[model samples]
Target: MTPMLKHFRYLSTSGIPRPFRSIPGPLSLPLIGTLYKYFPVIGNYKFSKLHINGMKKYKQFGPVVKEEIVPGVNIVWLFDPKDIENMFRCEGKYPKRRSHLALEKYRLDRPNVYNTGGLLPTNGPEWWRLRKIFQKGLSSPLAVQQFIPGTDDIVTEFIERLSLIEGQNAIDFLPEISRLFLEMMCLSVFDIRMDSFSDNELYKNSRSTRLLKSALTTNSCILKLDNGPQLWRYFETPLYRKMKKAQKYMEEVAIDLLSLKMSIFKDRDENSSKSLLDVYFSYPELDFKDIIGITCDFLLAGMDTTSYTTSFLLYHLAINPRAQENLHKESVRLLPEWNSPVTKEVLAEAQYAKACLKESHRLRPISVGVGRVLDQTAVFSGYEVPEQTVIVTQNQVSCRLEQYFPRPNDFVPERWLKDTPLYRQGHPFLLLPFGHGARSCIARRLADQNMLILLIKLSRNYKIEWKGGRIDTKSLLINKPDGPILLKFERYQC
Candidate 1:
């Protein structure tokens, strides 16, 4: 037995604490462990079906499922909310999450271009240092409020574009929603309006187009490399090379944008309000490269995640008539008209709109669950989990269980609202779509504002109708819509 296990076994006198080795899971083989089960033609599991596989594992293994995904990487999947609470409680000062190791390698490979593997993959003191610099400006509701006008302008522009395409055949929603989100991120980060909605075919060459392609490529590569065999680590596999190229292109674009923004920011008057880029530039400790890294992280991180979320929200609203009407009522009360400004004040009063978004999050989380590498040892579900064990809380699965949410399969926005009869005060740790504590999503406030605004405006402007098959999710690092999000937007005759 290893020193840590020996110590834990000796120290834990309580009979309730189960041995870490006692965790039940599929039989793991040597070196490859359970990874062979994910191989093509022979493997039973697919990485994209992580959420489904997780649910099956929970039912079979009884919550604490242990699996060695690769040779040296063992993960303990926690399904119970109480165990999840203990997991977070064991998280020390700097919470470290295990993710995107391939991306981390790519960034570290290019010392000249990247200081660290931007925000998503980095952890420990380096991650904390960077997080602290960013938290003040990005994590606050007030900070997001400043960009409301700009964000709403893009929302209005996108809504106009939607109207022109409304009565036509069912529109594919993901690409269009992604473009809209990219436009919003660019405006907030660089103070530049990417005419992504323009009819001009030259939009093919727009920064938004290139950046979105690169971001998608990067996300795809990360999933393949991280989940596949460890061939990339030993040498440059084709997939690894592809990811490197995409990341390099993204890095180049970020650097160029940061430089351009710096020039414009210097020329602006002292009285002018700062954009998100300007705010990052103001930080004395952050150099140009730091700003570029962060800017790229912010843009890439938000695109697919937010777009998928917005797409799902619209899908739910499209199907659930009562919920849609309730949201529409709220939006009309706050917005009054289609072109009404989405100020912070307007968003604050949008109670139903907020609940709808939250409900969507619960139903379809962007990630299967929150991941954490504990710094201290903690017991979970009677198992004495050692420090540094990677624990993935099955947030999506837990939220769907009838115990946690009544009518788990149904779309019920009322559950989130305290005044409603459907509301149940479930575990605090359940339904953490954005995570919790210091390491929660930094873009939480901004993403919420952007999605809520779109939800309200879309509801107010059009009666959403489904136009395609039931939307399922396939994990691409984060859970993304598996099929085309086809929808019809019928303009409301107010």
Candidate 2:
């Protein structure tokens, strides 16, 4: 073996002290860490073992375990809810741990949209400032209420499109739902419609959207391999060129939309009510580029997460018909009709539906977990985690711990029902689907409300079932069904 390979093998096998011995599960091979075992197994959708195997590791290694994949870096996998809370509590100081290879290769070259001051990517004061601004836009109860109609229209169209599918067909629901959700996000955030469903040049050939997807996909893969280039070289690559073009396209669209809105604002009577764009424009701190960055942030965040969660829920429901039956029955009893707005009370009443969503998220979080880098040396679980050490809190494993959840593997929504200890005692940090700390998703409430509306409408219209009595999941940025969710929709006889 080469000298570097020999060093990597020694670090993987013998660098750690006996007390911090390697956990009993998959064997870590020379220079490759656990990738050699995990990659092949997870590459197949039918036999993907990452989630299950990771959970097993947590059970064996306790809440905090260190794995030395390379000579200098030690990946500390944290599983306890308390530890997660502590990590998040240190938010600004403990910013997202930098991934040298992936971040440089895919993220740095991109214009600020993918790199925007939004919750997921930014750090320190910049992140806080953007989060504050976004929260102001998203927090207005009146503004959110105003968005309901637009969101409903989008979901209604989604239902209409789904109705056209033939009987007992296996179809991939990811792309369709993603497109619809992206449109909805655009409508709500920009107060303009892209109509992604109908062919439009902007929607069909959106260079920014395509580039954003590519960058995220490439980042995810390369980060896992730690094969990123140096900072200066990253900006000069072909990938970087694509990212820049995508950002430019996004900026052009944003500027045009902003100009149109500004004109309307000028034309309106002095007493006319302000829209979201009007409110956004009133803020002097934001420029055209900032606006474009935030807009792209909303689109990217909404599309992948909503579509993935929806797909995973469908996958679980497809496999567990009884859960689906219960959810449908609850949804029907609460809403009884699809034409009306879903009231807070009615949503609360759909206990099983909410449970199923939580259960799905617990099993398969869209991004898996959050990452943070220690700004100062800190001791965790009696081990000294030095400054700049990357801490990854595994949401999949943390949610499945028997202490926090009973029958974690099984599908049970009752855990979240009223008056239950599980409901009361569940740590908010542990149950974070939108992440935690100051950088959590700004559009979370809006997303949840829209999702609930879609579920109600879908349950009222169709009886979803698996094709050939089975469903499988595939991951490409977001976890989704390998094929579309196919079911027969009989018009509800009310």
Runs with alpha carbons beyond 4 Å of true place in candidate 2: 1-53, 68-71, 92-119, 140-143, 166-168, 199-265, 268-276, 343-350, 419-424, 468-488
Question: In model 1, how large is the Cα lDDT of residue 302?
Answer: 79
Candidate 2 per-residue lDDT over residues 397-446, each given as its tens digit:
67777778778777676677776555545777787777775556688777
Please give, for residues 1-494, the per-residue lDDT of candidate 1 as tens digits: 99557544544546678878998987788878898878889987788888888888888998788988877777999999988877777787899988888888987887787798888899989999899998777767877788888889889888888867887668887889998888888887788876776666237566677788888888877877875676998999998888888887888888887878888998988787668878877889887667767887876787889999998888888889999999888888888878998888888888899899889999899888988998877777678787888888999889889888889989999998999898888899998999988889988888989988888888898888888889877888788888888888789998
| Candidate 2 lDDT score at position 241 | 51
Clash totals, every prediction? 0, 5
Q: How close is candidate 1 to the true structure, as a TM-score?
A: 0.95
- State the lDDT at 448 in candidate 1: 89
Error of 2 at 469 (Å): 7.2
Clashes (candidate 1): 0
The pairs that clash in candidate 1 are none
TM-score of 2: 0.78
